[model samples]
Target chain A: MKVLVWAEHEQGALKDATLSAVTAAAGLGAVDVLVAGDSAGSVGAQAAQIAGVEKVLVAGDAAYAHGLPENVAPLVVALMAGYDAFVAPATTTGKNIAPRVAALLDVAQISEILSVEGPKTFTRPIYAGNAIATVESSDAKLVITVRGTAFAKAAREGGSAAVETVAGTGEAGLSSFVGAEIAQSERPELTSAKVIVSGGRALKDSETFAATILPLADKLKAAVGASRAAVDAGYVSNDHQVGQTGKIVAPEVYIAVGISGAIQHLAGMKDSKTIIAINKDEDAPIFQIADIGLVADLYSAVPDLVARV
Target chain B: MKILVPVKRVLDYNVKPRVKADGSGVDLANVKMSINPFDEIAVEEAVRLKEKGIASEVVVVSIGGAKSSETLRSALAMGADRAIHVLSESEVEPLAVAKILKGVAGEEAPDLVILGKQAIDDDSNQVGQMLAALIGRPQGTFASKVEVEGDAVLVTREVDGGLETVKLALPAVVTTDLRLNEPRYASLPNIMKAKSKPLSTKAPADYGVDTAARLTVLKVVEPAVRQAGVKVPDVEALVEKLKELGVA
Candidate 1:
């Protein structure tokens, strides 16, 4: 099986999720990474070092900048003849592009597969991770999105994959990039963070949510996350939401403050290696999955814990 | 300008789904069903566009069993001008649903097509992009803010990092994300009047699309349950446990 993996990069460096995707692709068979962007050559160099990658296909063009699905999908479809399966990280970019590629190829897409049972069969979570379904696709060419949290990252070095430049498809002229308001954070990205400190509605307001959560996150050098309730309540931006509908994170240490632990919230972080819950409500469902539970008011407990840490 | 919104009926967000004893699939025998929350937001956004005079009409569509008409009625009550109910008793995957919508769009020729990012049931966020690909139009997925500016729609998308805004030419597809808008409840009068609104029933064959399962389900099972662990007594003890675990 020859698998093609889309390389996701930003600011000239490959994202860590792409490494996880490469690892997932390696499971199927020989892996080739596709890096398409204005600065694809540099990103291609980074993708070449990933362990188990056989070759890195670089398509450098101005039209491919921003990783627009309109242009990217067609590019993937153009190269579909040499590969039997296409795998991408189930990030926002991958989700946006993979479905379009599948539709263009007239095939069904398997979204966010958790495991590769066979070449054609995979297991994925459904109903907000309430159930796992093992599905086998009959499509000739399989299009899949891998959940980065489920796969281990491929080693970043010790590979000598050859980088080859591929021709680019010009502008699709359907959509244009206007502008972006990317969040600036010094801490680790949530999906790649080793430790995450998440807040909930009990933070009362945005000011308190930040004031209380930031110090603790900073002390641990962890990424900040928020429950859907907190995001809906305007305690934080939508990007900070960690739930079934939001970003999934499985950090080494996950600390929940003031969260009641709804099923949706647990679906995103239940895979964490260690879970610690701090809520005054002793019966909050979050305590059930927490490895260490502390029944205390977050306002007092968080500050004390931060000082101690 | 006219807008098309595709809604989905799914298990109520509040109810926890239970896996069947035999593990065929989620038991939906007696579970409460409602319009998918994101689709409700999509309907609300389309209605708001109509009220703002940017759109002349808002038409909703739902593809499922006869019960899906109930979901269409809810969207109609939320101020949609009319609805199209495509009846199908069996499961329809995202790709087939997108093809059916493509056929509907060809007949309707609306200025914009809006849908939920994903149905909470399958959690497959694929239809909007697939429809765009099939119809040869631009797509704006995970849209938190949508603005119509004459010939183009400026959509602010909720990405992994933050918000990114893109400009798509007219007659594009957009999928709604959370924080787009707070959906309004249908008033009593609107609910009563929606019963009189125009709703046309069609079949997937009418669109010349085959609704068949392309993926065979080997089995369904519940995820591994996480067990509750030791509860510490005090802050110092919690800190001690953390140190013992080498996470602190």
Candidate 2:
């Protein structure tokens, strides 16, 4: 079986999500990476270096710069003739376009596949990870989005593959990008960080969340994350949210301060290597998955720990 | 302008689902069910649009079994003018659901359609976009803020990088994110009034759509459990443990 993997990129570099998607697509058979955007040439060159990729297809147009689903969806649909399967990471870009491609092809999409049992069978979590359902698709061609955290990033450098240019569909004129307000952070991206410090509603307010969590994050050189409660409470930006609806992370160390560990939040961070929980409430659900639990007031405990670090 | 909001009834967010002993599916024999949380936000946005005079009427719809009428009533109590319940006995995939909704849209000809980004039960997150494609309309999904302009809706979406703003023509589809608005709880008086509201029921066959499962479930399994680790007495011990693990 031949698989086409959508190589998502940002700032002209192949995003980590693409690497994980390559890891998933490699499971089926030979993988060909498709990079569609203004900077597809550079991104395709980078994608060609991934170990398992056989070739990189570069489709470029000024219209594809913003990764708008309306613009990107058509490009994917146009290129789906030969491949038996199409795969992309379950990121915002992938989730937005994969369904449209599936709809255009008259096939149902299998989303966020956690495990691939065969060419057509997969496992994915449902109900906020409270249950796992294994499903099999009988469609002639499969369209899927793989959860990045479920797969290891494919090797960055190996045998070089040939990069070929593909035709661009140009703008569909259905939608236009109206600028974005991405948070500029000096720390590592939350999803790919080695250590993550997450705060919850217990941080009370934004000022307190920054005052308490930032010190520890700074000391440990960890990316700062927040539970949905913290994001909904306006204690932090939604970009910092780590949960079922937010960015999923499997960092080396995950420290949950004041997070109650609702299943939604746990679904994002439960796969971390070492988990630690600190909250005033001993019965917080976070303790159940925590490799080390500390029952203490975060206000006092975080400060003391920050000073020591 | 009539606004259509599709709500789904799923197991309550607080309830932790249990896999059946036979590994078929989650046990829903006697579980509490409520409108999906994100769908509640969509309903709230539609009602607010009506209150703001941008929408003349709010019509809440659900495509599910008879029990889904209860969810529609809850939406009615939340200030929807009417409800449409498309009854289906078996499972319906997102593509089929989108087709059913397209049929309903053809009949109602609403100016706007609002829906949750994804149903928590399946987390497919495909219906709204697919419906937009089927109906040949633009869509602004995962919307955190929606502004009704003349003949268009300016939506601020909560994207991965940060927030992205987009403009879609009227007769568009908008999916609600969590931060869209805090859904108002239905009051006693409104609940009483909702009992008298018009609720029309139809089957998928009436819409010329088949509510059949496209994907077969091989089996359902309980996720691997994470054993709780040892608890330390205080912050110092926790620090020591982290140091021991070489994470600090």
Candidate 3:
């Protein structure tokens, strides 16, 4: 059986999540990988080292420098017709590209897959990450985007995969990227961050959020996340949202501030290695799973935390 | 330009969902059902395009049991010019949903199609991409920002490492991300106006499609619960404890 995995990248280097995606694709067939990025980027060489990948297809150009939906969907669709299954990471890029590729191919795709039983079957989460659901995909080309954090990174001792080029033509009609203001942090990216400090409604405003949460994140070199209530209240942008409707994170350390741990909120961060919750409500559900529980007002506890940290 | 938007009816996101006692599926007996949040964003994007003159007409569609009409109503209330309800009780896999939409596209020939990156209920972000492929159209998924210029669409997308931007041709599929746009609640005036907007219902058979569950729900198990742990009164004590636990 032939399989293909979409290698997500930025500026030319492969994102760590792509390795896990390749691992998921390997379960089905003899897997090959493909990356769309700039010509001078390291993603091609980086992809060449994944253990199970037999070949890596590079569609590198100025237009392809950024894996845009337009350039990627067509190339992936055109290349994947020869494979029985295709895989991509469950990151934002894969989520955007995988669906379009499946749509273009006229095949079923299972997203946020936790595991693969065979060529076309996958196990994934449903109901706000509360329940596990197994699904099957039919048609010659079955595609899926894997939850990357579930698997370990690719080891460097594997045999190298040959790199090939896909001469993709044309563009997708829609949207342009002007510029982005990334969350200014010297910390690891959220999914990859070992430490995560998240805020909730307790944060009265952005200033308070920055004052307390930023220090903790900076001290631990962690990522900053927010509860759904916090995002909806506009204390933070939706990108920082962590919940059933937002991002599901599994960092090594998760700190919840002024947050009541609703089941939905906990579902996203329950996988963290260590959970610490600070809230004025002693009976808050967050305390149930918190490895460290601090019962105090956020306004006072926050400054105290900053001084101590 | 004509744009199509697809939505799904799932347990209202605000409503906490729990597994059924029989170990069958999530209990929906009395839980409120509404359009999935991500799909609401999709519907909103389509509506915004129409409202802003980037799109001339918006077509909203959905496939499920009779109750899914409620989701279609949300689309109408949001601003879709028309609605198509494909009645099916069987769970529609992403591929089948794509096929049904493909069939509709053959008849409607919309310029672009948009849907949620993934439905919060199923957490499957597949239909949009599968449909885009089925129609042999380019696709942009998880777009934070989408702009229509002539026949090309430029999209700014969030990524794992950071953000990246790309441009696509028309007749593409664009799945919405969280930052895409805030979906406006349907007001009383628009809700009343939606009562007159055209919402037609048809069976999956009418579209020559057999709506069967391609993917079976083998089991539904609640995630393992986690318990609380050590708490230190001071940072010095906490730092010492962390060192003792080998996590500092």
On the 0 to 100 scale, the lDDT of residue A163 in model 1 is 95
Better of 1 and 2 by TM-score: 1
- Indicate which candidate wins on DockQ: 1
Alpha-carbon RMSD of each model:
0.8, 1.3, 3.1
TM-score of chain B of each: 0.99, 0.96, 0.96
State the lDDT at A133 in candidate 3. 73
- Give every collision pair in model 1: none
Work out the iRMS of candidate 2.
Answer: 1.2
lDDT of 3 at A14: 68
User: In candidate 1, how many Å is residue B65 off?
Assistant: 0.5
Model 3 interface CAPRI class: medium
User: In model 2, what are the clashing residue pairs, if there are any?
Assistant: none
The 0-to-1 C-alpha lDDT of every candidate, in the order given, reads 0.94, 0.91, 0.77
lDDT of 3 by residue, B159-194 (tens): 544455666778778888877899998999999899
What TM-score quantifies how close candidate 1 is to the native fold? Answer: 0.99
